[model samples]
Target: MNGGTDLLGVVSSLLGPGGGSAVDPVEAAARVAWSALVEPGDAVGGLLVQGLGAERSFALVRAAVDDGPELLVESCRDAGLPGAESPSVLTGAVAEALARWGPRLGRVDVLAALDAARAVGARLLVPGAAGWPRAVDDLGPHAPIVLWTRTGRRADGPAVAVVGSRANTVAGAEATAEITSVAADRGCTVVSGGAYGIDATAHRVAVAAGTPTLAVLAGGIDQLYPAGNFELLRNVARQGALLAESPPGTRPTRWRFLARNRLIAALGAATVVVEAGARSGALNTAHHAAQLGRSVFAVPGAFSSSASVGCHRLVAEGRAQIVVHPEDPVDTVLGRSRHATPGRGRSSSSGTPVLAGREDPEVLRVLDALGRRALGEQELAARSGMSFAEVADALALAELQGLVVHGVGGWTRA
Candidate 1:
């Protein structure tokens, strides 16, 4: 801690104007090292950092470089850190960690990471920082050691995590938009994984609603992954906040994506999955939320849908409650009364526009599938990912109100 003066100097210079928690310069500098040295979900690293202060933890790693686990384990045991009670077990773990960390030791350049953050006007946040979201502390040993944030604004309200598949359907998109709209109306911050499909839709709606939206990234704050969402994420960084566990130049690996989901789940008071396929990553987020004892909501999708499979499974297993009403989940989580149910009528004064049949999931799915130029039942069924029987029922209802017209080519918009 005392010898990191050069690191402290660089950190002082690179610290930007973003809203941040007040942390000790030495502690913050050591965290920068940990963030740069380890992978996103390094449980060993997290445990060590939490057991020993960042300064001591970093020093332990440095000391163990030659002195070995003898020094590291003794230090942790002396600190009364759990797991150190068994010296043999802790020694083996520490030795493995030290070996993995040795190669990266020489490369830990605190200045480079800070410079990259400074270049993007990002700020560093460590646990106990003033701006740190306390909800994430629920992660316990899995908590992030450091969070690199751009815009650095701290949202002052409850947050809801909206997550879904990257390959989303119209119904899924509609459901996400509706949920996001209601969340924003409740003055809740919307948290998302800054990916495509449902994640993108939720962010767009939250942004349009002028609500504080947080986008957690798997990569560095300097490089927003999923190139398609760069602008949208930039908008979020400009207006609300963008956070990452990695330092400034880290590329998002698959492991990191899964790791960042925990951050998303922890940040929100509740996590809602609008749509997810059998293998959707959003389910991982829901799992993380559930583990943290956060409320989880799943919007029902067509039984024929491949997208909602994960959500359906979650509901069936009672891991998550079904979202009968978008606002119902939000209401329950925030412990407030629901707004008057969204009828198939005009937009409310709250400025939440209601789409016809927005209350009817299948009807919304069918309507969204109809598009500018539509086809017959067969195509509609395929396009909407609905069974022909479901499409027929929806089309029949829509045609009764001139919502569609059957032509020689097929069914087109009326």
Candidate 2:
């Protein structure tokens, strides 16, 4: 093993100066190592990083590999790993994680990965870095240790993930464009996987609209996957960013794509499916979003269209809210604003920007009217004894408060 590798020196030379980087050099190097050492979204690995920090965890892995996991239990405790409640459970989990990680310790060269990354002008980002987006932290123990990105330190705004099948129809493409256009129009960063159909459409629209976008790759940012989107990925990197969890020289595998879904889901406030077949991989992203408690929406197509089968399944199973209105995705991303552009508040002294969801009478009234089902403004106004404009504004305000969610058909309690 290259345990003697001068991590600080290697990273300092390879990454150079990053304009007062908040990340520790050794921590950065260790993250680059972990990105290759473990598979994507490894909860045990995430926990190790969370508890021991990247640099220390990397050392722990190296030690366990050379020796055995038996001696590392005390080290884990000394390192302050927030293991399971029971001591035996903690010991068992550490043993299992070490067993899985032991094989890769000697194979991956952290310094080489960093050198290759810098060779391609890719920037390395570790947790707590200035440009790092905290949203992915929502995944908790499943979060990534490092992100290799080309531009934009963090997404840092409203983002909605638009994804669907590679074999998309013209209609599906059109719908995807509309969603992306409206989202970008409202100043939301459209996040996607940079795949062929719907993902490409979303990126193209975001780029064309001159809005920030993020394309999260399953492989490496050094080589854009799907050879066709090379230029498009470049445009995305230029306007916003091209990011990946896998290190340089890594290929996209089926399991990696599945792991990538959780990242796409975590990066956005919502996930939108334009079109998909019964087994479309986009469904995987949607399911991940649902698990993370992020809103999910699916655009309905013709009942007879096979491409829409998975979308229909989402609606039928009550997993996703239907995108009945064109503004739904925009609302999902930018929080249902009717007049204001996404940035800054038009608030006076008493604007009620952040409701606690129950105290405000207007919010409570809207929630009571919403009850169990989604309703349009007119129906809510009539039911809640409020005027149409009042209901509209209240719903808009409540959407931001997370007290209610507008699913296009109407509004419902969150």
RMSD of each: 16.4, 14.8
Residue-level lDDT tens digits of model 1 in 236-267: 98768999889887888765777798899888
TM-score of each: 0.78, 0.76
Full-model lDDT, candidate 1 = 0.76
Q: What local lDDT does model 2 show for residue 98?
A: 71
Measured with C-alpha atoms, the lDDT of residue 278 in candidate 2 is 61
Give the Å error, residue 346, model 2. 31
User: Please, what is the whole-model Cα lDDT of each candidate in the order they appear?
Assistant: 0.76, 0.75
Off by over 4 Å in 2: 1-20, 77-83, 152-155, 336-414
Model 1 TM-score on a 0 to 1 scale: 0.78
Ten-residue segment with the worst summed lDDT in candidate 1?
345-354
CA lDDT, candidate 2, residue 277: 79
